[model samples]
Target: MIIARLRSIGKWIVQKQLAEVVVGLFVIVASLFIFPGADLGNLGLQMVGFLVLVVIRLYPGFSVVLPLFASGLWYTGMADHTLLSGVLAYIAIEFAVARGCIIIAVILAIEWLVFGYVVSRDFNPQVEDLPGVLFEFLCFGGAFIIGQLR
Candidate 1:
């Protein structure tokens, strides 16, 4: 019975495209290792945001609101977890492409806005944050374009 349950769980993961979920969790773990001083509460919030992105895979129609919700959680609770946002953005854009909808534009706009807000919140923009911000935007755009091609 236990083996049967394990097999069923594996099937569910395959059907749900949950490899992204596994990668997200790994990113979280790696973040913990990289930032040993990270706050537990902030990491917890990041985990929640990651899980919400996974939910988006299950309910593609919720793509609109879920990304916003996850961004809010990440920005307000833990702006340091930028990798989580990258993963979230990739998954959202892929979902939009899979659904063959123009919502991809909306998702891209939302991700850009969230990224800007987070970067501005964490850095002094009037000084020298432009290049870094532009690079980050390019990274996001690359993820979106790759999603489209996929």
Candidate 2:
């Protein structure tokens, strides 16, 4: 029964053009650069999201929501005068770890904001289920990453 279901799912994915998975990989790479400090393992969640979207035929929404959420998170909790001005402040260092730190901080905030806005706007308010599901997913994922990294 499971094999039959898998076959059905495979057929569905092919019909929906799952061939675009490479583009998803490119987005992941770009996001890592733009949102530094998101290690590969963190990005793996994004990749899974992208693939699931492909399988379910909702890739666009996944793309829009993830980065926006991460960006929002960055701006809300991480960005600061210390982060923004660190580049100049750390001028003496051959490598500006402070600047890199601040930049990553900014990315995380921005990502969260984008996520909150997308879910709040796109997910139906009347039906709380979808939003609840996403919240749980984010919480679990975030906690797992923090715990695992520690």
The most accurate candidate by lDDT is 1
| Predicted structure 2, TM vs. truth | 0.28
User: Which window of ten consecutive residues has the lowest lDDT sum in model 1?
Assistant: 118-127
- The list of candidate 1 runs beyond 4 A from truth reads 1-15, 61-84, 101-105, 108-112, 115-127
> Model 2 scores what on Cα lDDT?
0.39
In candidate 1, the residue pairs with backbone N, CA or C atoms under 3 Å apart (3 or more residues apart, or in different chains) clash, namely none
Clashes in predicted model 1: 0
Q: TM-scores across all candidates?
A: 0.62, 0.28
1-150: candidate 2 lDDT, tens digit per residue = 999999899876544544334445556566666677764444544544354334323333333344443333334543211111111111101111122333333333334333444433443334445674466456534533432332
RMSD of each: 5.8, 18.1
lDDT tens per residue, model 1, 1-150: 999999999877755657566767777888777777777555765565565456566665554564455456555754445444455455545545544554654565565455455542653344356685677667657656755664
**Distance from true location, Cα of 138 in model 2, Å:** 24
